[model samples]
Target chain A: MRIELALFASLEPYLPEGESASGRRTRMIDLPGGITVGEVVARLGLPDQPRVCFIDGRGVREDAVLTDGVRLAIFPPVAGG
Target chain B: MGSLLRVDMACLTVKKEPVPAGWAKYAGRALTDAIIFAEVPPKADPLGPANKLVLAPGLFGGTPAPNGGRLSIGAKSPLTGGIKESNVGGQFAHSAAKAGLAAIIIEGRPADPKALYALDIDAQGNGMLNRVDDLAGLGNYETAEKLHAMKGDDKLVTVTNGPAGEMLMKAAGIAVSDPHGYPNRFAGRGGLGAVMGSKGLKAITIPLGIESLPHADKEAFTAAVRKFANALKEHPVSGQGLPTYGTNVLANIINEAGGYPTRNFSEGRFEGVEKISGETMREITLERGGNVKHGCHTGCVIQCSRYYVHPDGSYWTKGSEYESVWALGADCGIDDMDGIAELDRKCGDLGLDTIEMGNVIAVYMESGKAEFGDVQGALAALEECAKGTETGRILGDGAEATGMAFGVERIPVVKHQAMPAYDPRPIQGIGVTYATSTQGADHTAGYSITANVLGVGGTVDPLKPLGQAELSKNLQIATAMLDSFGLCIFVAFPVLDIPAAFEAIYEMATAHTGDPWDADALMKLGRETIAFERLFNESAGFTAADDRLPAWMLTEKLPPHNSVFTVTDAELDSVHDFVAETAAEMGISKP
Candidate 1:
């Protein structure tokens, strides 16, 4: 089972070296079956304080269950006028 | 107290006066609105002699407050026919504050038709207005270059208008200096630029100074400033996200939320959003040798501004921020990033408000004056605007003018000004602000985007009208207070979420004034200002009927969520009722 991890804004730096920091998708990562959203973030070692991860465009908590082929996107807090 | 300069353009006279006793504590919008309410007749033609232009810096300016250098330009708006207080981030306000000057008031039009005046604060520390005959009809960039060259110093801070203003175009904005001496920051709304142009004054310059204005409690102010800085640094939005991707970061987030306002607001999202998202902009900026970590003024920790460069590596413009990007790119059906940046540069050169200018261009496209997705045609229209051609002059005024000229009935405007980056139908909170703002569809006037979209203060559903009235009212009052202190509105993010963050602001503001101040005092100040503005608008003929979304917003349901501006007319009227109640609490009598 594989869950595609996408990063946006400052959170993109935590992705693998070949992964792009902005719009273009660099590569997809394969995660173990039955992985929780929290487990994926912990594996990436991204900062815990400033991240909002979305699954299929809906925001999910750390305890949210991940399914195969789910497109997960993460971003840091961004507020502007 | 800081001094005020009264520049009487009609007689070509300049006077220095002590700050009025009653206005001693006011700054920014609060200060400007007070002066306008007292001196300007509500019925005065905005481009006529009776109208006056007031420019003021925020209270924390010349201090250590991060992003505290915002300047507020206020007048009777030629576009909205209502009071306007437009804010800009730049070095002009900061420099004026350092020189112990709080505000500059330009009153009366020139006696001579073509007499162009330039106000200069000399190295000897004396300020004077001079007639510069050669500077007539120059672009903003050319004007900045000529002024800097004539001054022969890198310390010149200038606020000037460009050809759009000279043409008396309603969308004109005053350009202020960035840290690098570029004229990029703008008080960019409500046709205030046309007021400046009518005066026949081109630029006002404040010489750079080293001395800091003394605070009543220096030690306490310093400590409080430190606390506030710490608060900003710790916030992920201010400290990291903005510095990393700039304000354009919202392109992706808003698009993802299905509230991006594309193609004359016919749709809620853009298909080509990824091409112009902040993430893509950042990568492109780096590839093109641009500086993404720049601020509009000094001491801005949340460097949400960026300077873009051409593909050939030469500088283009300082920014095409989220709103400008949306107005030009998605709103017009053009998704080209470079073309959008070029349009931003053109607007800056013309000293036009990009948001308003884009709205007009989009309306023109809707009327078949130009084709959708025609970046070159849009650029050509801007060129004609600068040239002041017949068609150019009509479109230059604003969206309403373009709509009328083209005989297009589906014009999206409130109180004669164009709707900004957000479509109020999907983002109902902002829509409430648009229909009801004193300044006419200004997003920053009462930004409910925090609650509706970003979840900064509290969660309010973007799709539903539930609890939106209260949310907009609270934000408008708080935002009014923040503008008075000269603190960047971005600080409200942390101040909203963290008690200590707000306490730091409260402490810093109160400590500097050496007065006993609290949340109630601040709220009172905001409420009174609102009452005063409302009175001015009322005298200018604004009614509850004027505070309404365009008819299309009610009948035309937005996509994705299929939401109209569900916030009813009664609910929208409630926002002002709260202001009136607060005004009554503060002993402010409505006119």
Candidate 2:
């Protein structure tokens, strides 16, 4: 399965090399079928920190499964207007 | 322990009276709301002589305590037709407190409606209202510059209104001087500026004084201040995330959560979210040599404010915050960052509430006056507002009026005030706050987003109705207390998670006021304050039915999650059950 992933704010540094300077990046990547969000984060070597994750604009937990064509976005903790 | 200054527009008199013994702990919103409830008649016309405008600082204002420089401006709102206390971050509060003023009350309307005057407070906090009709037509920036010159003090803070306010537009907000002497910081909600303008008051210049705020125990106060500042420095949200990206950082996260209101709330997400996200803002601002980290006033550790720049590296305006960005950009279907910044600048200069104006313009678009994403049309509508044309009047009045003029549904307002960035359908907890808040659709009144979305204090399912009422109730109580202290709302981030930080608030207040305050006393004060506001609203004819989301929000489902606002009406009413409970405890009979 293939999915689009976007990392924002401080998490942008974990994006593929040469794309981290923008402070945000979106890229398509291949993933195994029915892979959980936590496994993808670990496989991609993303930092082990508290984050807000979403699959196709719906907030999801780390254990939530992702399928093909989903757009995944992750951001570091943030609050305020 | 400063004096209260009363200025009568009808008599052109300025009187000084010692701060009431009972008002020792009252500053910011508490002081303002108390004054309004005690003095103004409940049914008084918001724009008439019977109305009064009160300006107050927090208990910590002008102190060495970090992030204590906030002002609360209150009145009977022309927009919401309810009691209003709009808070702003600026130098005016610090200067007023340093000048030995607890509050400034403006009363009566000028006999000549077209007359204008400027209220000047000297180093001794003695106020004098001087006739200054020349300032009548000036914008906020020009008004601040002119008042700054008239005062002849480099550190003088000017609070002024623009043409929108002079026109008595309900969307107008009063602008306060920032550190740079720019009238950028705003008490920017509830049509308080219209109240100010109706008084024939053009500007108020207050000098930053040399004296220090008296403390009950300077040593204890110093120690508490240190703990609070250090806690703010240590908190991730305050120390790092905010300083790095500013508040707009929430744009992507909120959009990802499907809570971001888009295209006048016809949708829940914007396709152009990335372009207007905080990450993009930081990159653009830094590339243009603009400041990505700035403070609105002194003693601010978070420094979440910023300066936006033009492509040529020249200053454009203050960086739009998350609310402004979403209100003017996504809600209006515009994605041009530069365009949004330009619109923000216009709103600031015109002394209009950017949130209110944006929502109104979106309603205008729905009426087919212009299409969504028509940046030029939106700009032209603002120009019309400045000129006070017929169409401009409709837009200037706010979202509901514009919707009525265009015969459009889905106004997205509660109590006639426009909603902020979040759509309540997907974010149910915030909806509860919006429906029941005394101030009318103000997010800061409760900010359930802290738990529902940000996971600041704790996590509550944003889409779930359970536990939302309790969450909003507790938050609203804490917020009322926070506003009374004049502490920045950002301080709540640390106070929520850091035990020392929460303890330090009461410690600092106790030492500063010598009132022997504790956490319980402060929370009771919060409850009592809210109860009075409720009483005033009830006297003004608002009933439980007024505490409800618009019919569309309850009936129509928002996209992405396809969720309707599911919080029951009973749950919404329960958020304010404290009003009656507090009244009973305080021995005040409820009407």
Candidate 3:
């Protein structure tokens, strides 16, 4: 399945070499037909720290299963008003 | 010794007194709280002649501490009728410290209501209180520019109020000059500006030059400062996240958590989140040829401030931060960035609290005074405040009054002060702080989010009601200590996780002040600061009943998160017990 993953702020430093810049990265990976959102974070080598992940615009838990051709956004340490 | 400058408005007298012994133990908010407790009588009206306004710089303000130029302004709030401490960042603290002044106390209102006075302190430590007529009715921006022109250099630091303050509006705030002569930074909250206005004072200006004070161990201080700065550079939030995105970064996160208050606390999410989030702001600024990250004062490493520009690269606004964005954008149901920018500009010009002003307008909208998503109507409301019109009078009365006027029951406030952007139903820990803090509903009173997130062993999940009261108690005490040091709360992000970094800074303070102390001693001082404020509030007729969230929070359930503020009254009462136990652990008795 193919999907796009984007990182922001300090999380950009943890991205793979070719995908470390300021845009989205397209990657293809083999899955067991269906995989949970937790598996996607682990597969991308993202931090294991608890954080909110967004699929398109809605919040989804790490255990929620993902589908092909979805856009994922990963964030680190929430901060706001 | 750092001296106190006292200005008596009625007599036009100025006195400088040496700093009292043991005051060095507490700085910033702690010091201001102590002073307010010692001098002002509780029964006195906040707008009456007996009330006093106290301003104190943080402990590390003059030094090269990262994000350390925070100033605390304490007074009896005209709006809340409780003890209040409002903190802001500006050049005033650095200048005041350079001039060897510990705090500025203004007391005794002028007998004449029409006369306006300006207080100026020169390099020789001598102060001049003059009656300046040209400053009357001038907005903050124009007042600052005229004062700068009158002083004829960048040597003077001016703090002024707009028509909102001059008109004695309950939501008024004092504006301080930014580095670029823009009156952007503000001591905003609790209607302290109205207190100043009631005194018949227009502004306070300090003219300072480069001067160094004596240090106990310069080498040790330098070494500890360098180590602390290095530690900050290593942390993600302090090192990069804050510098890159400022506090606006939380818009998306809060929206995702379903905790972002939208449209008068009706929902927890806003559909136009993308336009107001930090990422979008950075992108928009870049496209508009503006600087995304800028520092507030000298020696600040975490430059979370920014200069927002328009499409033509014109100066649209300065320091368009997170609270202002949420208050003026999401809460008011206005999604246009240009409209938000214009509102920010108007708030700056009028010397008003953006949070209170925005919330007041939303109340007006709810009452059918204006329609939802009416950006032009919002602008017109701000214009009324600038011109001091009849509608402006209603708008300047703050959230509680506006809510009362409109008969809106969903008003989000605690202690008569408007709550900040964070809705407490989902994040219950902050709700605890808002309820218990002496400064009324303030988010920065104790920002326990970091400690809670790091799972610092005893902390509870924000989503759960269990142990949140105790957690908030600890955070409030710790934050009081940080505020006393005059250190920026942002330093706590790193200092909490790595205690050694803060220890080094504490050692430096002890070495400089020649006071025998450790971390435990600092915590004791924080407790004392809180006790003093509590005492003041108690004397001012505030019982435990006054320390609570608005009724709507308990009865209403915020959507998406589907969480109601489940912390009961008994749990809230236990918070005071937790504070008392902490004091006992430190071998201190209750005040």
Candidate 4:
């Protein structure tokens, strides 16, 4: 299964190896059946910090399972207006 | 009683006036708006001698009011041609209060443009107005350092502008330095810096050393303040959501709601949103030896501000919050956080409003003057503004001018000022406030987020128009009352959920003023202030016609959300009707 993952703002520098400098990471992985977002986050070596995660355009809980071709975006806390 | 400091730059003379009786009832935005309405002529050019700039501390500014150290700067706006109030947080509010000064009004331009002046208010209530020739043309970062270096910083607050204001650009803002010497704090909207620049004043620096703010009843005030602070600490929005993520948490939420204005508002969502959301900002700050969150002013427990640093631990910028990221990054289609930080730094240095300038640049990009997602072009646009070139002049003139020059149709403005990050098509409640606000398209005018949840007598969905006018009216009244107290509006989040918290603050004010009043009276006072502003604007020739969204926003249907501003013109006109009725209820007649 393949997924497009992206990080936001100050978290751009924390992307794993081979990720785009723009904080987008596109990867192919062979998952052991349906995997929860928390499990995927752990597998990717992503920090277990406070953040808002979204699948496609809608917000989802961390326990929501990820499927093939999911567009997952992870963001840190906001500092904007 | 705190003294009122009036500086007439024309003669380089400064005078101290007694704080008017009963004026303490109003603090930050409320006081500034009242002063401007009372003294400034509505028809006066915002950049001319007749206009005045008033800076007032919030009602709870110097005290332990949660998030209370907000400074409101008000003037006739060069951008909106209406009354404007831009609020910011820094050490200035505390310093101003401790120095026993209620507010400082800068009036009348100097006869010589070459001459620059700085107002210094010391701890003993003694002050001097001096010529600051050496500090001219320096950015805020440099100006703050030089001023503090000369003044010996026990607790100094410096408000200065960069080359943008020195050149009288309409987008210029007045930069107030935070406690850490970061020039991140700004009253950055509606060209207030240009107004200050027009007055021929460079900066106003106050040194903090005074003992305490004078309150009529110290015990009551302390108890009330403590009660309110505790409420804020316990409320989920104030205590947790904001402090953890700052305002950037709204990025994903707004995007999810399809209200986030992206790519110059041509779209509702940005493809590059993940790179600039609040969650990412916190993670990166932690890795780079930066603070994810810090307080804006003294005694603020809800620290929704952050210090973003370079990878090497050097300073990048302070408080790169949601608005800055949206305007400079997503709106312009640039996702690089470093690039956005640089723009934020430049705007802070130049004393310009990043939101207005970013929208202006986006308009230029839409017109083919610059390409979308062009980071270097964005930097060049800012440099042009700093240089005050012809290109810069057009850019500096703000969103409306840029839209006119570029022939772009999707210009997002209300009352001549560019709209904030929220697209009003979907968020219809906020749209009402944006259109009717005296400050012109300001999100802070009456942040309707509270009314959006509470519902107005169960008459309609907050997202619908059924009870929006009444909700908007109440919020505006509440906002005006809060602004005058010089209290930060964020305190309202907790106050909204915990009704007792507002009563406590009101009790403190009533005790201090020795006036037998309740929450209803405070609401009336807010309404009175709004009515006064409306009278001023009406006298200056503004009418129902002027209170309108841009034609594009009205005609075009925003995509993805597929929402058009469905409110009718009659609905907007009805907003003014409520103001009139409220004025009558308060025993005030429309002039």
TM-score of chain A of each: 0.82, 0.85, 0.72, 0.73
Residue B120 in candidate 3, Cα distance off native in Å: 0.6
Candidate 3 DockQ, CA atoms? 0.31
Best of the two (1, 3) by TM-score: 1
Ten contiguous residues minimizing lDDT sum, candidate 4 chain B = B453-462
The fraction of correct interface contacts reproduced by each prediction comes to: 0.56, 0.65, 0.37, 0.32
On lDDT, the candidate that comes out on top is: 2
Q: In model 1, which regions exceed 4 Å deviation? A: A1-6, A13-46, A53-73, B123-126, B585-591
TM-score of chain A, predicted model 2, versus the true chain A, to 2 decimals: 0.85
The best candidate in terms of DockQ: 2
Cα lDDT tens digits, model 2, A1-81, are 978888888888787643222234887778889899999889878876677788887677899999998888887777768
Candidate 1: CAPRI quality band: acceptable
Evaluated at residue B576, the lDDT of candidate 4 is 63
Better of 3 and 4 by lDDT: 3
TM-score of model 4, chain A?
A: 0.73
Quick one: how many clashes does candidate 2 have? 0
Off by over 4 Å in 2: A17-24
Using Cα atoms, each model's DockQ against the true complex is 0.48, 0.58, 0.31, 0.19
Under CAPRI classification, how is model 4 graded?
incorrect
Q: After superposition, how far is residue B276 of candidate 3 from its true place, in Å?
A: 1.0
| Candidate with the greatest TM-score versus the true structure | 2
Write the residue-wise lDDT of candidate 2 on B50-124 in tens digits. Answer: 999999999888898888989999999999999999999988898899888889999998899899999989878
- For model 4, residues A3-70, the per-residue Cα lDDT tens digits are 66665444545555553432343333455558887887787666555555667644566898888877
